[model samples]
Structures are given as C-alpha cells and as structure tokens.
Target: MTLDPKEPVLRVVPGPTDINANGHIFGGWVLSQMDIAAGIVASRRANGSVATVAIDTMEFLAPIHLRDVISVYAQVERVGRTSMGIRIEVVASRDRGREEVKVTSGLFTFVAIDADAKPRPVDAPE
Candidate 1:
C-alpha cells in the first residue's frame, strides 16, 4: 500500500511527539496524518473546503516506533460530484537503514463543502 514517485501527492514525516505510550505510533496519530495528506489532495481537486467523510479498510502492517520517520503519501483515486475518494499510505524507515516499509494504509472519502458548510460539487482540476 505504498505509493511510488509517479503518484501526484506530498510526503509527510512524523515527529517524536506523534508516538504514543506503547512506544509505537498511535493509530489515531497515523489516521490524523493520513487525513491531513488526503485533505491536501481533496482540496486541490475540490477547489474548496473539504471534510473527511469516511475511512475504509485501514490496516496496520507494522509497528512504527518513536523517531521512525513515518512518511505519508496521498492521492485522489476517484471523484464524484460532491465527494472524492483518496488513497493514503503510511510508510516508515530507519533513515536509510531499513528499507521503507508500509506501516499502515487506508482509503479516505471527503466531501466538498462551501462557505456555508454545506455539501457542494467538487470542481475537477484544470
């Protein structure tokens, strides 16, 4: 569930504070990062305010320890009139030591919103 460089998206690295007491990255922390990444893709495609609607089939494959430098990549996989589906992958590596391993991944659905906070049609990218 990792993303190749060909995908149009951005990468994010989490910091030490992102980890939890269990010494592994918290599931909530990971989901937040994915949401942020997905929001970037969603906003660009929607061209307006966007909110997370749903997350599907999220699976945590490996434990992400403190300072593991997790990377998140996201892309718009599908677009509807009012909503867009984004695919996000969370990967972690030990600074070129261990190869990048996918720690978790999921699909997030977002709905475009207007200034009034009402669902609106997502504009296709130019």
Candidate 2:
C-alpha cells in the first residue's frame, strides 16, 4: 500500500501489555509497529518478500499513553538494486489531547529476497 505521511498504516489503542514500567508505551512495541509499516511498503515496492537489513536514525520523540491511539506512517525513501529504504513515523492521539504528536521516527532498510531467500533486484522506478 502507498502510505502517505498524512495516513497511517495501523491504528489502535495501546493495551496494558504494550506499556512499560514507566507507565507509557514500550519502545520496542513502537519500533515493532514501525517495522510492520515499513515492511508493507517494502514488500509492495519490491514485488516480493523482503527482509529488514537495518534501521537508522531511530528516535523516540514523545511518550505514548496507554489509551492513546497510535498511528504508524511509512513511505518509500529510495530503492536500490536489491535494497529499499523506508521512512516511518509513529504518531499518537490521546482522547484528552487536542492533537496528534509524533512519538517516533526512523529509517528502515529492506533487501528484496527471492523464494530461496537470496537477494533479488528490485524494479527501478521509471
């Protein structure tokens, strides 16, 4: 799916299991959400299976509350012969809050893989 910065790939409330001891959403949970969102973009662009190669410049900007609605946005940043880069941003909206705040952002790298799990070339943009 084509994910726009204005749109989110996943939206849901954070449950107790998603929280940390600090009374806020777990950082790992947030990163996992971002990874899923990025995977969608990568898979669609690659037209095949892909594996996460790396994540760069990941930053958590704000705390997410338990009842907050999390939105994960992803977009393709670039594509290489066998790798693609995606930028993902996680935003949160609380019931009592007036607006959504950006909770996290990162760059994800994925490499296209064939049926045999070997690296495969990704199609070039025309």
Model 1: worst 10 consecutive residues (lDDT sum) = 1-10
For TM-score, the strongest prediction is 2
Off by over 4 Å in 2: 124-126
lDDT of 2 by residue, 64-102 (tens): 999888888888999889999999988888776678898
Q: Let me know the TM-score candidate 2 reaches against the reference structure.
A: 0.91
User: Model 1: residues >4 Å from true position, as ranges?
Assistant: 1-13, 95-97, 124-126
Candidate 2: lDDT of 111? Answer: 94
Instruction: Report clash pairs, candidate 1.
Output: none
